[model samples]
Target: MSLLFKELDYRPTPIGVLSLRRRRELSLDIDVYEIKLDDEYLMSSLFTDAEIALADLGLADLAGDSLDVVVGGLGLGYTAKAALDNPKTGKLTVLDTLPEVIEWHQQGLLPLGEQLSGDRRCELVHADFFGASLSDIAGMNPQRPDTRHDAILLDVDHSPGNVLHDDHKRLYTKDGLQKLATHLVPGGVFALWSTELPEPWFEENLAAAFDDIRAEVITFRHPLIDREDINTVYIARKAS
Candidate 1:
């Protein structure tokens, strides 16, 4: 079998608690790491299917609506790239908490980063999405008027039920969900990528925040290998 990219060990300075590795495929670079505490295979570049699903399914109907999009995680830049592919997207904002992740992308570890960064429509912010203030986003491009986003796609951590940080659990709570809902313009959409099926309670919580909600299982064939895998995509639309 042919390999996409070669894997190289990566260790970020100062954040010595965790170990990360990167591999370069024919066109894309993948990062694999063991996050501290949980010790789970915290993240990988293998599941870009989930990322694209978040972008494609979430913004499918809003094709030419002059939309602003906010993506919570910048993993591999797949979601951001997919979102930018839509002509309907007027502005694209991506938020990530890890400076290392951003730096890696900026330095060309992720092949798509340079193109996305160079795009006049895309903005990359290094901050925790949950803590980002509305004013901060509005300030990104002062020339453009402040407008609530048409879609928000979040893939910060794992599914709500399988979160790596205890604090992230609040993002799934009623209050947290309400905060997310408030950021959306009327009739806007919110999409989340889940590594597994979300908990029943979490699905109910999503229903409470939006008037319409839909969940689908997306199957993808591995880019290099023929193996098939599935991930969950949750899409909700704000009430008009």
Candidate 2:
């Protein structure tokens, strides 16, 4: 007999209802963990190549033996987990606007939560990535107020023009880009995962704010759809 578990966890978040579900796939004969916001599916364990690539592509050029990094958003823990997997990453700070999401990681409600929570190098912080001011982040670290991380991996919103919340749209602007650049060390990199490819205005904005910039398309096969879909990762290197 095929076994299935129906202990789906759902909680009301400020934005909407957040849910975490784990169930057995009859045909696949495996467990799949999924997260949803109201009626919209946020993420699933079934696909994580691009999420891992966000960290991989961002920190590709970092030559140092030890690096301090920050990741915005803790969706399925794939990005943070990828950063931890890097031998060069000395410290990792993950920020998420949703407290319920953080609680899921701490409570071991997800597959990778126990491992991520147990890692001494990883710090899961509850903060708004875009809304935070210099002083606010300085509060997270008294010494380094201006530049803190070697890389900042962001997967918070849909894209530059598209956002998950009203307040998050500002981060896509030139002014917002300037604030994020201050967090990276000299020659640091910023990578953003987007459901759509880079828009012209957004690409121009990044070029104006940073040095070299690249937009990559990640194509993957989706069995459910029986077709291939495309996602994008925008990478920009901060001026040294």
Candidate 3:
């Protein structure tokens, strides 16, 4: 591998080939880390405004300290770090279906791995977030089964319409959302990150199970294109 680019690790997962890589950006004089699923780039360290915003916007909706939060994806640990950064956050449970991703953090392979894993407030767990969302008994934290949280931030799929797996499609529906709501404390916040623009139909589905729904568009500079790009963060709160 060239000094500018290196493939750190690769593993075959049920969904696809999971890989972690690091590359040097001479133009910016910075090191960039990336996670990939086969040919598709799952996440990059350079662009994480939306991921951070997912946690910010979600936790911002709630009022109180010692907030119990659950993040539905591990990715590059951007969202998890953001949640832990908030002083209001007390305990954070991060759930991901892939054990490799969770191991990357525990082994300190990723950039934010050490920061997230070292924090006593954060717990990285190997679990299917989508499956837990629809489950009333298991909830987001399998160890603390049936326990509700103050905030639930999700960034697993690309978008409500464009899901990574067919099984994830159910969680986007009104019925699926209603089931997810049961996992949250009353008046708790639920936020989601999407690469595409927010759709009205999805907002309608969220409304069925939540109140004070808001679709926030987060704009950030695209590192590759050197132009503005946008991602959506959907925030909703369960009825009190």
| Global Cα lDDT for candidate 1 | 0.73
Span of 10 residues, lowest total lDDT, candidate 2 = 133-142
Question: How well is each residue in 28-123 modelled by candidate 3, as lDDT tens digits?
Answer: 888899999999998999999999999999998688989999999999999999999999999999999999999998898888899999999999
lDDT on C-alpha atoms for all candidate structures: 0.73, 0.82, 0.92
Scanning candidate 3 in windows of ten residues, the lowest lDDT window is 131-140
lDDT of 1 by residue, 1-240 (tens): 233434433554442444345444543444332223124455566667788878999999775656889898776788999899887888898887777667766776556868887899888877777765233343222334366778989887778887756767787877777777877788989899987865678789999888899888888887667888778989989898
Give the TM-score of each candidate: 0.81, 0.92, 0.97
* lDDT of candidate model 3 versus the reference: 0.92
Each prediction's RMSD over C-alphas, in Å, is 4.4, 2.2, 1.5
| Candidates, ranked, TM-score | 3, 2, 1
Clashing pairs for model 2 are none
On lDDT, the candidate that comes out on top is 3
Best by TM-score: 3
